[model samples]
Target chain A: MSDMPSCQFESRPRRIVIGSSGVQTDFCSTCSVRPNSICSVIEPGDISRLSEVAVEAIVPPGRGFIEEGAPATDFFNVTSGTVKLFKALPDGRRQITGFAAPGHFLGLAVSDSYAFGAEAVDTVRVCRFSREKMTELLDDFPKLERRLLEEASNELVAAQNQMLLLGRKTARERVASFLLDQMQTGLLPGQDGNGGRLHLPMTRGDIADYLGLTIETVSRTLSWMRAQGMIEVGKGYAITIVSIAKLEVLAAGNG
Target chain B: MSDMPSCQFESRPRRIVIGSSGVQTDFCSTCSVRPNSICSVIEPGDISRLSEVAVEAIVPPGRGFIEEGAPATDFFNVTSGTVKLFKALPDGRRQITGFAAPGHFLGLAVSDSYAFGAEAVDTVRVCRFSREKMTELLDDFPKLERRLLEEASNELVAAQNQMLLLGRKTARERVASFLLDQMQTGLLPGQDGNGGRLHLPMTRGDIADYLGLTIETVSRTLSWMRAQGMIEVGKGYAITIVSIAKLEVLAAGNG
Candidate 1:
């Protein structure tokens, strides 16, 4: 399987790379890139201030950026890689609250700390904006402030959708929905416009826990999908999407 | 039968007064009130600013504050009323998204429009903060901004919990959990802290849609609960909770 992307998805904005010395950062000129953060909404003046205060860093697989209840260090935006944001129960169970794809901002808080923790699901590269700098930028750039508000609102909607899924759908339906989402989100590769096949990142166990089902059930469903030829599986957890239309039927329970 | 609350719940907040063409609404400060809406996070100074910019109004029974895609109005805090926030499919099926209790804010947004439609299940009163005033207040008051973030986060968690219910739990368990939540949230009056008993607000039909079950199934379960002496219901929705502990067990799937 190819670890590198076949073609660079242009929608993903390139990181504004500041040299390791972090000195003399380009705090000037009109940057046309639609930033994935509250930075996007602020004017040039606010961007300069944020650029001055913000630090950029890289996070590798299986590492965490934020922990629940900890005073937030910096608000984050993923330039690359996947970040799993989750909340923990004292009893050791973990519910993945969300996954931050590229262009997604990780932490944008109004308080001292965060209720959800952020962990790197894969090798991640990020740019950090301290709360103070971000706040200053927000004040200086009213548009940026509104964007943050918008992001929060959108987050609420996404959360509500997740709630509907967790609170209402059957396990099979959840798995089906998850599979279809992977296809649409470009998380799956190898589809040549026919939506034929793609690779899966987490294991069956992860899928089961995420959907609140046992691994055995997840295995059974995959086997069923394979038998129906709605899917064909290859080595290393790769699945060919033979018929998304049929899978949609299965997901909606008509099947 | 009485709309007036009989018992004053300690540690639980009563609804705030909606409209007072006055200077500041310091309901959160100095008052023995627990915070509900994002406004609860604001200090006295900011709350005063918020009050200056907001208007209070009462909503009659069965009326909605915002419809889907309507131009943004004043963001709201539900001072009094039972609100059912729901999303309806084109096919006319409705999913009860959330129930807004007292002290919780409704219609607060970072966008120009509301994504879901909100209607008062009963006569409702709300503190209305116009879009212009709200943006100004959020910009000026960082503490309030933080609270808004937390509120959004809390809403996010609630959505995730719903996902678990909708995607995994059995029909019986969903209804059971819904009942448990109502009791805990005071949507229905809880057990007298002695013998456990609860009154339900919406009917079995409502419960069926919310839990993704049929009305007949909901009715069957209610009958089952009665047979086990778990509850007793009389005319006019006089539902008596017999065993909170046992109900919790049932909700957890022990039943």
Candidate 2:
């Protein structure tokens, strides 16, 4: 287990998000989502200012946040739950384009309008900051600006990886990649690596939409994995990876 | 030409690299590269400091400027020519991930290292800035940080769109979309009121790599476009859009 680097974080970058109930504690400090989040990079001063300028908003499941051609309002950093960015074809076919976690930022646009729609996959919490306030922050802190730019570059890299998935990978390969990616992202809490178990967020349909396949295909692939004894699935999106070695092989396009 | 929006302007942002002698100009007013890039949301004061810290370097085609896992040293905004960012798979299958243009930033990463290598697609000129300088600039300039963040979001959008192409669209549709993306991105700069016309950088092989197809497929698709009178190919990489209406129709994944 130690052979695999701990990906325990990448979910909750920032701990502050106001729910209807009240302010949440600093869940980011020891939560599983801290390792790769920008929230970890924010200094005390930055966090203070961010808290001052940001608003916590609840995103109900299936609710729309940003849609294609909509004006860019506030940029969002998810604090909890999952979100999917997707596009619809002229024929009404839709593609789940990206999956955003708690630490990930969403709906940022250099142009005035967004080019994609951001929709919540589950009941989610997010930190929203005004574009203007963010601009002021950039002028005051060059390191933050650099960090944001670097973040953008990372986003592009991930996008390119997605392109490879869409362009080159087979359906089975895509499914394997998705499962591995979800596990490696480790946005959720609990499930200490007792026997290589993992958690999932979206359903079969969402996976199908993201991977450009049908729900049936997703089901078939999962069934195939089960038959191969590579994984054991339980209720509530729980998965025990019986063999990550084989899954990694599939993600490498060997499937 | 009068009808086409001219993106050219006097006094580009700034240069990141120190050496610019051999750097060819991409436009009359714009140097080979801009120092500040689109993320100039940072303050003029910070910009000046970063200008002192950045290093400029030039590389000919087929050479790499940044490797995938090396500590992030420099970031760049492309001034002239093309820079391709790509990820190398475990088995060494190169995924032509992205192509950077004039005024576009390069070597941007959220982490200390780049996920892909930056390779020159042409005799490229670049403005280089240290990541530390970028950090300072971003920390000081929230606007710049916001801009960079938004730009990254755009790249993510582009990647998702590319995913739709690779996963859902046919080879012909992929070619059409690539042509549209190239032309719209200003990679092909000279078109008149009649329609948008521009040059295509990289060969069919490059396009195939980017689009997740074989060179044979790319060439066949181009031939098919010509036979259908959708576009006219000229000397070098010049291409005239014989039918924008048909092109957009195909580009929307309708054809």
- Which candidate comes out best when scored by DockQ? 2
* DockQ-derived CAPRI band for the predicted complex in model 2: acceptable
Interface RMSD of each: 4.2, 2.6
- Model 2 off-target regions past 4 Å? A1-56, A129-151, A185-190, B1-32, B35-55, B130-147, B185-190
| Alpha-carbon runs more than 4 Å astray in model 1 | A1-34, A42-59, A63-74, A87-94, A107-114, A128-144, A170-173, A187-199, A219-234, A240-255, B1-76, B89-94, B108-114, B126-150, B164-200, B205-255
* DockQ of all predictions against the true structure, Cα-based: 0.26, 0.42
Write the residue-wise lDDT of candidate 2 on A13-87 in tens digits.
434656577965443344344445555566754456656666667777766676767677667778788888877
lDDT (CA) per prediction: 0.64, 0.70
lDDT of 2 by residue, B37-147 (tens): 663454444444545555456677777777777787778777678888776566555667778887787765666877777777777777677777776765555566566
